[model samples]
Target chain A: MGPLIPNGIITGDWNFVIAILVGIAFGFILEASGFSSSRNIAGVFYGYNFVVLRVFFTAVIVAMVGLLYFDYFGWINLSQIFILPTFWPAMLLGGVIMGFGFLMGGFCPGTSFTAISIGKIDGLVFTVGLYLGIFIFSESFPLFKGFYNSGNLGHVTLTDVTGINAAWFAFAFVIIALAAFWVTMLIEKKVRKKITEYKF
Target chain B: MNTQTKNNYKPNYINPYLGGVLLGLLVLLTVYITGRGLGASGAVKSTVVTTADAISPTLAKANAYMGKFISGDRSPMYNWLVFESLGIFFGGLLSGIIFRRIRKPWVEHSPKITSKTRLIFALLGGIFFGAGSQFGRGCTSGAALSGSATFALGGVIVMLTIFGTGYAVAWFFRKLWI
Candidate 1:
């Protein structure tokens, strides 16, 4: 019943307008949360600050639970929503590469944009690199076209994989996220105590 | 009350939990309204297609991948993600202004490294990110957050591998951050 745009309840013309509004909320939340700071973001790995882990896990759990509730309440049709298809090899490779990128650049695409908004030169350079890298991929598509398109697992959800209810997965995830938050906090305290130069 | 000044300025960052809740709700709203989640890398993908087309319509048209996005019917830039990405910039700008964080260009890096060194890695990092997003079919925003939220197995897989890999190799890049 919901998912207005997909269902035609909302006109196609409104897509762009909605995009801006949603994006604004996204950007505002990210910047206000201190994601614009590379040091803060990298802190997840260094154990100085665990804001990334805390915020990330919290958000995932909240959204996961919200979606399950929405489905149960008939507010939205879960089947109509888009799911990320499983492209096994490509995804694994991409995630590994992106992990390295996150470490070295100290920012992801979303965070970089926010940093650029505040006049960070490194952010600007990262943007330039994004273009160059993508352009290179596009130009060199022929070399890895087969490999890129090899994996073809269809769109699947955790319920399908585990043969359990979505609610169960949601429940389990909440527990896991909470535990992670707790442990990261301990690590953060210890790391910060040792590094006097680091200031949050 | 004490007057506000640059020297006495305070650093303000909201509680992580609060921020997460807001972000989570926003993600829920997006899926509810659009039947899709938010994305950042996809917007740049569009730019790449448009740029390739601009340089050589024939070449871009001939390339199997680039050609998939280039259409004679509509401009490549007229995309939902492109508009959304623009909003991200403006929204970030708004936040910066409110926080008094808007300032002249500067490089953020560890005290151990030079600005030039940081920039070089930033560029290289972006390049890897760009390639990875394409291969992964989404960036952190699209794949990791929105994907995981949606309960997609692939999203969860990507999220795990990404963070897992980061932790596995973070020790090697200690100087870059720590």
Candidate 2:
């Protein structure tokens, strides 16, 4: 009944078109939620604001739970979904690099695009840098190919590797999200009080 | 207060939780429609491949990673992520227009750092993020959000590492934000 493209229900050329429409909604929501602002995005780490955390964690949990429901109700074939393959060492290293980048740049690729649309010079520079980085990686591919392919774990899931049920993981995520929301609210209040000029 | 330089615009940001719910639903809809989820970095990757293929097809094909994207029937520009990312750009523009948030180019930085310093870090950050996305197989939205929604183990790892590392290095980059 769903996942129309993969199931032969929504055949042919419309798949990519629909992908664009969905991506538009995704981007619109991100921008409207203050994701267009690098300062707001960076606020999650600084305690002045937690919009990024609130939106990100909530969205993840909701999608996780929704996927479970879809599978349970037979609304979609969960098995047909594409899962990102895991390379443990690469992920760990990549994540660290990205983390450093995020703190320094205040915007990720997606958010930077939104920021650029609204005329942020920093966002534009960040994107140019992204291009350069990709170029460098391509030219130096032979040097790091070994580490990139290390710890290949196939396309495993949390349930697959942890032996825990998806429902349980979702439940744990919900609890953690709620707690973070509570704590961040307190932190934001404290941090905002100390600042003099910035207004959200 | 310098009234001339300041852009007096009312910031009407949507409620964060409601926005999150909408984003989550979008993710769910994407899965239901395409048997996958949302992504951002893949679009940039496509651009990189397209540019490389044009400069030197032989060199592009020689690199194993670039070859997969180059050997495709049409140009890499015709890829799904590329089309979707275009929509993302337009969607963001539409939202900015509707919200009246459009402004002249400016850097958002702390009082401590000069605009030049902020821009420099931003470029450096982008470099690290681009390279890292390749290694991790995705960025925050691609690897962390979409991958996590599907319960992928790599998604969890990427998510943990990104935020974990952010907190670890946030102190060093404190002047950039706080």
Candidate 3:
């Protein structure tokens, strides 16, 4: 009844149209949320602003709970949805590298696009770097191709790994997210007080 | 009056919780419709493949990584993520216009550092994120956010490691943001 494309409810021709609509919504929400500002994003780490954390965690929990409900109602086939395959070492290396990128650049790929839309020169430069980096990666593919494809644990989820029901995991994540929100609110107050040089 | 003006200077953005809900619902709708989640870096990869393929057909095909995306029938740029990414740019533009955030292009950096220094770091960071996305098979949007929302183990791993590493290294780069 759902996953309209896969189920033949929506044809292939509409795929790109849907993609565009979805992306528009994604970008619009991000910009309106203040994600276009690099400083706002970096504030998460500095404890000056917790907007990133709040938005991110709330989104995660909402999606998680929403998915569970969709599955329960049989509106969407959970099995039909794509789950990112686990590649342990590759993902670990990638995440570590991206962390530094986030701290330094203060914009992820999605966020960077929004920055560029708002006429950010830094965003433009960073995007150029993205092209170069990808080029370098492609040319150097032979060097790490083996490592890239090595740790393939295909399409497993947290429930699959820990044998806990997905509901419990969602519940735990909600609790954790709520707790983090409270803690970060306190931290933001303290941090903002100490730092008057930068305008919030 | 000074404090009031300072408060007024704050960015006029939606509440985080509301933004989160909307974004989350969007994710849900995307999955419900497409049987897949959202992505950002995939479009960049496609562009790279298309450009490399155009520049040197033989060389692009000969390469181990770029070769996989090359096809005889259609351009690599004719991909879903690529089209979606175009939408993201336009959407951002719309929001910027509505919010009046569009301005003459300038570098945004902390007062402690020069714009030159900020741009350099931004490029370096972009390089790392670009390379890492290839290794990670996605960036924050495609991997961490969309991945975790779907409960994928890889998503969880990537999410934890990314934030964990950011916290671990935040102190060293304090001047950049703080």
- Every model's TM-score: 0.97, 0.96, 0.97
Compute the TM-score of each model's chain A versus the native chain A and list the values: 0.97, 0.97, 0.97
At residue B136, candidate 1 shows an lDDT of: 88
Interface RMSD of 3: 1.0
lDDT of 2 by residue, B16-129 (tens): 999999999999998898888888888898899888899988889898778877765788888778878887887888899999878888887777779999999999999999
Q: Write one digit per residue (lDDT tens) for candidate 1, span B1-178.
A: 8587755555588899999999999999999999999889998899999988998999999997889998889989999899888888888888999987888989978888899989999999899889888888898999999999998887887798888888998998888887
lDDT (tens digit, per residue) of candidate 1 on A1-200: 87888999999989999999988888888888988888889999999988898888889888999988898899999999999998888899989999988888888898889999989999989988888878888888899999899887889888877799888888998999888888888888788888854567
Evaluate every candidate with DockQ and list the scores: 0.79, 0.77, 0.79
- Candidate 1 interface RMSD, angstroms, 1 decimal: 1.1
Local lDDT at A59 for model 3:
91
Q: Identify the runs in model 2 with alpha carbons over 4 angstroms from their true place.
A: B1-10
**In terms of lDDT, which candidate is strongest?**
3
Ranking by lDDT: 3, 1, 2
Candidate 3 lDDT over residue span B1-178, tens digit each: 3464533566679899999999999989999999888889899899899999989999999999999999899999889899888888888898899987887898888888999999999999889889989888898988999999999999988888889999999999999987
Name the lDDT of candidate 2. Answer: 0.88
The fnat score for candidate 2 comes to: 0.79
Query: Model 1: number of clashes?
Result: 0
